[model samples]
Each structure stands twice: as C-alpha cells, then as structure tokens.
Target: MRSCIWMGSEEKRMAPGQSGPKIRLAGFTKFEKKKSKPYSYSRTAKLLERFKNRMSERKDAFGPQVERLTVLHATVKKIADVERAKKHAVEQTEEVELVE
Candidate 1:
C-alpha cells in the first residue's frame, strides 16, 4: 500500500487512487526583462503633474463661464417669477415698447 504523489506535469495524479511517476521541474522558462530603459520615478511624476496642470487649466478656463451661468440662472428665475405673477393677475398685459 505504498503511494507516491504525481509530481510531474504529464505523469502526476491529481487525486487519490491515481498512480504515476514523479514529474521533473526542469526546462521551465525564466522571465527576463525587456531590453528597454527601466521606468523612471521622475518621468512618472512629471507625467502625472502635467495631467493635473492641464485639468486645472481647463477648470480655470471655465471659471468665467461658471459665473455667467450663475447670473443667467438667476435671471431666468426672476423671469419665471414675473411670468407666474402675470399669469395670476386678472388684468390684461399690454405689450409696451420702450424706445432706448
């Protein structure tokens, strides 16, 4: 009742009641680094910083647009309030043209 673990890829047994010769671990390929310059910390940092700077520049470009949008939103709200009041009024509205 002697048993041995199937240690070889082609001859190894994966479960009980399996019998086979021990597998050899030879000829396994070793990982070699590619023939190129290794990664640099400074280069990575510069790339990340450039990305952040570009994003900040875009945000700055939109700064004035944001203020305009805020003012436009307030103006639209006021127009809506006026329209609501006009709708609630029983008096007829006259279209008056002001000569500037």
Candidate 2:
C-alpha cells in the first residue's frame, strides 16, 4: 500500500470576512477596553544586567563545591580500595598452603 506524510499545509482556508467565537455573560452590562501596559526599557536593561552578573557568579560559587565533591569522592574511593586490600591480606594470612 502507498503511504504519504503531511507536515505543514501551505494553503489558508479562512476567508477575509470570517469571525471567531466570543463568550459573554447574560447579565453583563459593563464592558471596558483593555489598555496595553507601557514597556520599561531601563528596568528591563537593569534586570538583564543583574541576571548576567548573577549567572557569571554562579560558576565561581559552584567551582569550589564541585572540586570539594571530587576530592571527597576520591578520598572515599581510596579508603574503599585500602579496605579491600586489607581484607585480601587478612584472608591470605589465614589461608593454609598445601605442601606437596
């Protein structure tokens, strides 16, 4: 059987005079126009600058913590290795060698 895959349609089906649905209450009388809020360029710029500074400081803060964790993990691994070696040593000491 033949098969076809559809991605995005290039044609527009909506006409120029067509309108969408609107919701309204039965007893509503007051209808106020929504006003667009004014954009603050200075405040946005300041916040973006502060955000960049905080992001830069995060690396320095986490750098020490990451190093500390690495050192702790390495120390723990070394202790485990020493413990394993000690166990092998004790087992070997308690073993009886077969005489030929």
Candidate 3:
C-alpha cells in the first residue's frame, strides 16, 4: 500500500495579456468620507406652518359637529343618572313595605 502526502498548489501566474493594469480589490476601509448638507430651519418652519394650517382647517370643518355631539352625550348621561336614581328609590320603598 502506498501512502500519499497532499501539498497545496503554488500561486497562479497571470497570463501575458492580463498583466497591464492591476485589478483593484474593493475593501471596507477604502470608502471616501461623504459630505452632508446642513439642516435648514426655514424648511422646518415652512413644514410646521403647513401642518398647522391643515390642522386648523380640519378643526374648523368639524368643530360645530363635535360640540353638538358632546352636548348630546352629556344630556343623555344626565337622563340615565336620573332614571337610575328613581329606580333605586322605588326599590327602597318596596323593600321597606315588605319589611313592615
């Protein structure tokens, strides 16, 4: 039985036609520092102004309807509270009569 030892191949020699300009290998540390534009206060102010205008327009369109609904809700809640108190009073009177 013959035992064989494995050996790694030598570095590849470039072909004669491929020897002109060396190929550049891209690496993580080779990036250029990028220049960022400065923030503008005027642009931010304009955006905020437009947002506020749209919000005010929406509030103006729905303000009266919202107020009317709120008032109706409060009136309905008051009526329900009054009916519940009356029901409790009637139950108390019935219980007292039964006790007597």
Candidate 4:
C-alpha cells in the first residue's frame, strides 16, 4: 500500500508497505526565520571572562548573591559590635556636664 505524507510545502510518497520515517523539508514562508549573527572572538572572550568572574566570586558554591549578603552581614555585625563597645565605654567612664 502506498502512503503519502504532507511535508512543509510538499508531499512525500512512500513505497508499498514501506515503513519509514517522514522527512521534512525547509520551506520559504512570508515570515522567514532570521539568521543569528555569529559571535566574534572578542565578544566570546568577554563573555567567558564575565562568566569566570561570576563563578570565582562565589564562595564555596554558596552563590554570588549569598556571598554579597554574607559580606554585608559581616559589615553590619562589625558596626554593631563597635557601637556596643562605644556604649559600654561611655557608661563605664564618668561624664561631667558644664554649668551655664
């Protein structure tokens, strides 16, 4: 038995009792797909550099954002410690008020 398969813009016929995969052909249409521009060597190198920097910035695979957050947390903690120490020192020391 002969079989016909409808391809992109053409029809494909199969031999009698021949079981085969249908082949598709590229067809031209009103809205043809736009071809992508090839990446230049410099552009590719820049992309690789950016990717490497991002990967290196990660701390122990915690991710870049996590690394940033950790740094921020450490800074805040340090500031808080300093402020606490200052408050403690002020409380321990005597402060005299001037009489007007």
Global CA lDDT computed for model 4:
0.63
Per-residue alpha-carbon lDDT of model 2 for 31-97, expressed as tens digits?
8678978544444444544555555577676676555555555565566667668888887777744
Worst 10 residues of 3 by lDDT: 1-10
Which is superior by TM-score, 1 or 2? Answer: 2
Q: Candidate 1, residue 58: CA error in Å? A: 8.8
The window of 10 residues in a row where model 2 has the poorest summed lDDT is 1-10
In candidate 4, what are the lDDT values of residues 1-100, reduced to their tens digit? 7778878899888889988775555773346678999764445545555555666676478576655655555565566667668887776664432321
Candidate 1: C-alpha RMSD after superposition: 23.4
Give stretches of model 2 more than 4 Å off: 1-61, 97-100
lDDT of 2 at 14: 42
Q: lDDT rank, highest first?
A: 4, 3, 2, 1
RMSD of each: 23.4, 21.7, 24.6, 20.4
Question: Candidate 1 on 1-100: residue-level lDDT in tens?
Answer: 4445644565433566666565456774665667988544445444544554555577777676555555555565566667667765634333232322
Q: After superposition, how far is residue 89 of candidate 1 from its true place, in Å?
A: 1.9
Quick one: best lDDT, which candidate? 4
TM-score of each: 0.29, 0.34, 0.39, 0.32
Q: Best-fitting candidate, measured by TM-score?
A: 3
> Which pairs of residues collide in candidate 2?
none
lDDT of 2 at 95: 75
